[model samples]
Target: MDGLFTYNPAMVKAALGTHMVTGYAEDTFITIEEISQGTTSKTGCDGETVRSVDPNTRFSVKLTLQMGSPTHKYLLNRYNRDKKDGNGSFPILINDLTGKEKFSAINAWVTKLPTNTKGKEGQNKEWTLETGQADFQIE
Candidate 1:
């Protein structure tokens, strides 16, 4: 309406299959990146330019969670399942209740497990997932 808007991290919801993700890391919670693997443009000797599109819709999502959290355990289980049998692909969805931002992926899998470091305190675990195609919108 006017210049009054509210935002809260708790309003945002993220899920992988039936598991709801929570216990996000304090530093950075989540990040999504679109992977581009095609060509952009090429210029010829004269003044002609060739433009092309890759039409690649691949994307990746990174989620940082508290170590030993339930979310981390869920992802670890999925990763183990995938490594064992290769049937661990699942759907992912992220929705921002404060705004109209949303991200959805029909097919996604964990790229790799998070590295562990032993220190005085428990560190955060970062889980990375790659998707064949992802539908994302921000406004």
Candidate 2:
């Protein structure tokens, strides 16, 4: 077989709660980041070194949506509700249909509302979600 690969944006699916985000921004629509747990190794007084592992899995998922998109509105509503009462935590999932890559968070919450920027042309709204533990896989 030849060494060729293909990628499609339409095959990438992302969902927040019960809503599946489709109206994404122009470029770099969604991004999943893994937050560093902690230092895995340390040096001792002599020439000895000690190693430790952190089992915490933290993640930050950023979703950039087109201005005035339905998903954006939904996120805004969630933000408002969460701000009023501390009861807005949902699961998030991002899966790529073209491959065996998936990212998910069992317990996630919106960090805050995206910044508002207005001009002649509308700007994109970026929403950030944080999770204490997340499952991430790429292949």
Candidate 3:
């Protein structure tokens, strides 16, 4: 138990929650726990000069999911089903593993699903789901 020579252990956190998409199935469950990063618009933004900053700008979040999972399948199903019906915002919650009473979001919707399917055999099929919100909560 020599602290000075041991590497620090990782701080792991599971992301599991539900969000309303197209009202196809109220409270669609995102059942995956091997999350790596939960990020926001701050992930790649620079501080503005004091004189040019706009305080009214809204920040968004992007959630990435591996392909072939139930969550991915459900979202893909929704996307294929309702994408032609016009896009709209819905509530979302990126919560703890229990899928209840955790983080909360209002008026959010996926803005992009960049298909960067490259490699000789169509590898790298991960999906990036970007959503925007006017309000967010984590408790």
List the global CA lDDT of all models: 0.89, 0.85, 0.39
Q: Can you list the residue pairs that collide in candidate 3?
A: none
What stretches of model 1 exceed 4 Å from their correct place?
Answer: 37-39
Please provide TM-scores, in order, for all candidate models, with all chains considered together.
0.91, 0.90, 0.42
RMSD of each: 1.6, 1.6, 10.7
Over 4 Å off, model 3: 1-57, 96-103, 116-126, 136-139
- Residue-wise C-alpha lDDT for candidate 2, range 16-53, written one tens digit per residue: 88988877898999888878755588787897988777
**Which 10-residue window of candidate 1 scores lowest in summed lDDT?**
33-42
Model 3 per-residue lDDT tens digits across residues 1-139: 6645332112112232353222111222232221223332342246643333333324444444433335555555545544777544455555443322244445444455647565554232333343433333333
Of the candidates numbered 1 and 2, which has the greater TM-score value?
1
Best by lDDT: 1
**Number of backbone-clashing residue pairs for each candidate, in the order shown:** 0, 0, 0
Candidate 1 vs candidate 2, lDDT winner: 1
TM-score-based ranking: 1, 2, 3
Residues 83-124 of candidate 1 have per-residue lDDT tens digits of: 999988899999999987999988889999888877789888
- Displacement of the residue 53 alpha carbon in candidate 3, Å: 5.9
